[model samples]
Target: MNFPSKILEKSVEEISQLPGIGKRTALRLALHLLEVPKNQADNLANSISQLVHNIKHCKECNNLSDTEVCIICGNSFRDDKTICVVEDVRDVMAIENTHQYQGKYHVLGGRISPMEGISASDLCIFPLLERIKEKQVVEIIFALSATIEGDTTMFYLYKLMKDLKIKFTTIARGIGVGDELEYTDELTLIRSLQNRVPYSQDLI
Candidate 1:
C-alpha cells in the first residue's frame, strides 16, 4: 500500500510482521497510533520495549515474569505436591483462567517433534525432573495438547519417572483430538482437568 509518509509505512511493515496481523490491519493501527497523542504512542512503545527488555522467565516454571519467581510459584497455598505440566506460558494462562487447579506448574517450553527437530533435551525436562526430586512431588498432571507431539512428550515424561511412585494423570477427553490446550475454552479445560484419568498407553 502507498503511504503519505515513509515513517508510517515503516511502522505498518513492522506491525504486519506480527502473527494474525495483515498489512491492512497494520496500516490502520499505524494510522491510529499517528492520530493518538504523542505521549500515548510513547507509552505504547515504552510498554513494548519493557516487555522485550525487562521480561524474565520464572526460575521455577519458566513462565514469563518481571521478577525471579512467578507469582503462582511464590504463592504459599498452591499445592506443592502436584505439578501440572504444560507446553508454554500460553497454556499456563489458559489453565489459570479456569481457576480449577491449585497445583504448581512445570512448563516444558515445547513438545517433542521429530519433524521439527525438537527433542527432549531441547525442552525444560531436566528442570522438571529436578523439581520432582527436590519437592517430592506426588502427582503429575499432563496438560499438554491433544496431538501426536503432546502425547509423545507425555509418554517420554511418564517413562522417565514411572518408577518413582508418583501418580500420573492426563486431562480427560473433553479436549478434542489435536486440540491445543491454549485454545480450549475455560469450561472444557476445567471439565477435562476435573475428570482427569490415570495415564495409560492406551490413552496415547
Candidate 2:
C-alpha cells in the first residue's frame, strides 16, 4: 500500500517490524498516533526509545529495571531460595499476574531450542548456577511452557544442577481451575492427578 506522505509509509514500515504486527495494523497504528495529541505520540516514542537507551538490565535476573537489580530481586520479602526459572520477561509478567508465587525469578532469556539455534551457552544458565552455588538457592521451579522446547530446556537446566543438593520441580500442567475434566486432554488429566497436592484450607 502506498501512502501520500513518505514519512507515513516509513512510520508504518518501522512499526510493522515489531513482532506480530502486520503492515495493515502498523498503518492503522501510525494513523491512530497521528490522530492522538502530539504529546501522547511523543510519550509513546520516548517510552520506546527509553526501552533501548535508558533501561537497566538487572545483572542478577536479567530483568529490565531502572537500577542494576530489578524490584523483584531487590525485594527482601521475596523468597530467594526458590527460583522460578523462565524463558523471558513475558513469562515473569504472566506468572506475576497470577499472584500465587512469592519466589524470586531467573530469566533464561530464551529456551534451549537447537531448531532456533539457541543453546544452553547462549542463555544465562551459568549465572543461575553461580547463584545456586554462592547464594545457596535450594528449590528450582521450572515455570516454562509445557512444550517440546520447554521440556528440552527444563531437562538441560536440571541436568546442570543434578549434582547440587537442590529440589527441582516443574510448574503443574493441567486443565484450568474452571475447566471441565471432559474437555481436558488425556495427558493433561493424567498429569494433573499424578501431581495433585493435598487439599489445603488456605487455598479454599
Candidate 3:
C-alpha cells in the first residue's frame, strides 16, 4: 500500500533499518521530518553525513574520535595511572555522565562472545596491553557489563594481565545481572564506581 509519497516511503524504510526502530516509529519520524523546515532536515542530514565520514577510532584507546586521539586520551586532567576498560564507547559515556571517575578509558569495541563469533582478538585487547606497558598505569578497572560475554572478556583480560603488578577492580553489584552499563542510571553508576571491589579479593 503506497499511502505516502515515494520520498516518505524511502525515508521510512531507511529509518526502519536502524536498531530498535520499527516501521511505525520510522513512519512517524519520516512524517515529522517532512513537516519540519527544509533547512532543519538538511542540517540533520549534513550532521549525520559528517559524523559518518569524519569520525575515526582513536589510535590509543580505540574510542571514536575525529582525530588520531580522543579528547579523553588527550586531556591532561584525567588520571593517567588508571584505566577503565569498557565494552564500548557508550559505556565510557555512561560512566563519564556519572562524573565519579577521573581515569582514562579503553573501549574494547566488543565483548568476547563465541556464539556471536566475536573473540578476544576481535576487540582492542592488544592495544590495552600495549598501553599498560607504555604508561605508568597503577590500576585497571573493568566496567564491562554483567552479561556472559562480558564476564568471559573480563576473565580473559584478568588472566592476560595477571603478570602485571597493577591492581584490578570491577564495578560493584548495584548494576544488577543482565543490566547493561549504558542503561544504568547516573546515581547507580556513580555508586557502583565508588563501591567498586577488587576482583581478586572478591574471588577469594
Best model number under lDDT: 1
On residues 1-204, what C-alpha lDDT tens digit does candidate 3 reach at each position? 465588778888899999999999999888888799999989999999999999999999999999999999999999989999999989989998999899999999999999999988899989899999899799999999877888899999999999999999987657776889999998779878988767885444
What would the per-residue lDDT of candidate 1 be over residues 1-204, giving only the tens digit for each residue?
778888888999999999999999999898898799999999999999999999998899888888999999999999989999999999999999999899999888999999999999999888788889999999999999988899899999999999997999988668888999999999889878988879999987
Answer with 2 or 3, whichever has the higher TM-score.
Answer: 2
Alpha-carbon local distance difference test for all models: 0.92, 0.91, 0.91
Worst 10 residues of 1 by lDDT: 169-178
Candidate 1 clash total?
Answer: 0
Give the winner by TM-score: 1 or 2: 2
Model 2 agreement with the true structure over 48-147: per-residue lDDT tens digits: 9988899887888887789989999999999999999999999999999999899999999989889989988898887888888877898999999898
Question: Could you say which candidate leads in TM-score?
Answer: 2
As a whole number from 0 to 100, the lDDT of residue 69 in candidate 3 is: 95
Q: For candidate 2, what is the lDDT?
A: 0.91
